[model samples]
Target: MRYNYPHANLEFAVEALNISDESTLSSEDFATMMPRIQSLALRTKQWVTVIGGSRQVIQQLVNAGVSRSRIRWVAGRDADQREWATEQALLAGTSSVVLSFLDALSSPRVAQRLKMASKVSQTHSFVFRSLPSQSPLH
Candidate 1:
């Protein structure tokens, strides 16, 4: 299924983007997400923070048409650090969108914290997870 950004009432929302493979982050899926990212970036003119994204993934986002200047790639080596950074980015309200590629978000507690933070800061957040044979923003 194609994932499109919800155009209305986007604030205070935290969603998930499930990927089947992490080793070979599929370009097709990443391409599908670009439009939403681009739309959010263009609409808000704010930074989009990417937590736990590798350099290759960052490059893919740039290749998919998101401006390099508008992206803030945060590569936290520690899982706790990455989760903390993701929450902070959402709570800070400096970024219009926060995209977290952390496995730790699979935890309900972590996801809940992020949801609250996004709501409090009114930031649109997307967390990427590795789930088998599924690729959709839920």
Candidate 2:
């Protein structure tokens, strides 16, 4: 794995992979996506968001000796919590917003909130989503 430890913190769009804890996805997906992340990271001054709730990945980054000062991992169950996370990320100058469990909620309210976050963040923010197949969200 090409681990870039001690990444500088900034804001960028988040892209989600399989997203949910429901799937045992591979690291290859992340490898494939990282080039894009790296490209965006190079073009702009922002942090790339790895959209998932996997403590393993987070821990891996930490274990790889990535600076905690540069990365913020958002984990919670409420949409409002996510909203709060968005705000925190912006304040922290995060560059990406990755949304997992996209099919967990179909309410336009959530989508609107995320959209608003992106809008509010301007080009500094990007959103990545992973939707389930034929799923009904809460």
Candidate 3:
């Protein structure tokens, strides 16, 4: 697996990668694999988001080394908020991956706008979804 380790202290996005973490590596060694978290999840994209993911899921990913700096963690405080954040990030030309559980709540109108934005900005978007949500709609 690959990883992306952008400098947190730097003013600009400096893309860096580490391609391998051997079998003998320890938990501390995984810090070396932190960028691997991003590269594996993000691919050619620049960011990853946990859209409508429960708080626990978001926390676990962070504990597992997906840099908090690289994630736009969304708890669905509301659907509009998540969609707005997505739109803003896409407008800023951030290539992004979304781990979405609220598939039905996605805004097609917002998505259409994002489609235009992505085309204009030349960005990439990917969504990794498996289990669906059971939470009652508000």
lDDT of 3 at 29: 36
List the RMSD of every prediction in angstroms. 9.1, 10.3, 11.6
TM-score of 2: 0.45
Global lDDT of each model?
0.67, 0.44, 0.48
TM-scores of the candidates in the order shown: 0.68, 0.45, 0.46
**In what order do the candidates fall by lDDT, top score first?**
1, 3, 2
Q: What residue runs in model 2 are displaced by over 4 Å at the alpha carbon?
A: 1-31, 42-52, 59-68, 77-80, 87-103, 123-138
- Give the best candidate by TM-score: 1
lDDT tens string, model 3, 4-78?
445221222222211111122232433364455455554543666655555555666677656667777766566
**For every model in order, what is the number of clashing pairs?**
0, 12, 4
- Model 3 RMSD to the real structure? 11.6
Model 2, 1-138: lDDT tens digits are 332324433333333222223332334444454445445544543454544345554554445444444455666566456555654555454564332322243455644555554544542333333223344767
**Positional deviation of residue 82's Cα in model 3 after best superposition, in angstroms:** 1.8
Better of 2 and 3 by TM-score: 3
lDDT of 1 by residue, 34-130 (tens): 7887667666667879987667667766776668898898888777888899889988988877877765444667767877777667677776652
Off by over 4 Å in 1: 1-29, 130-138
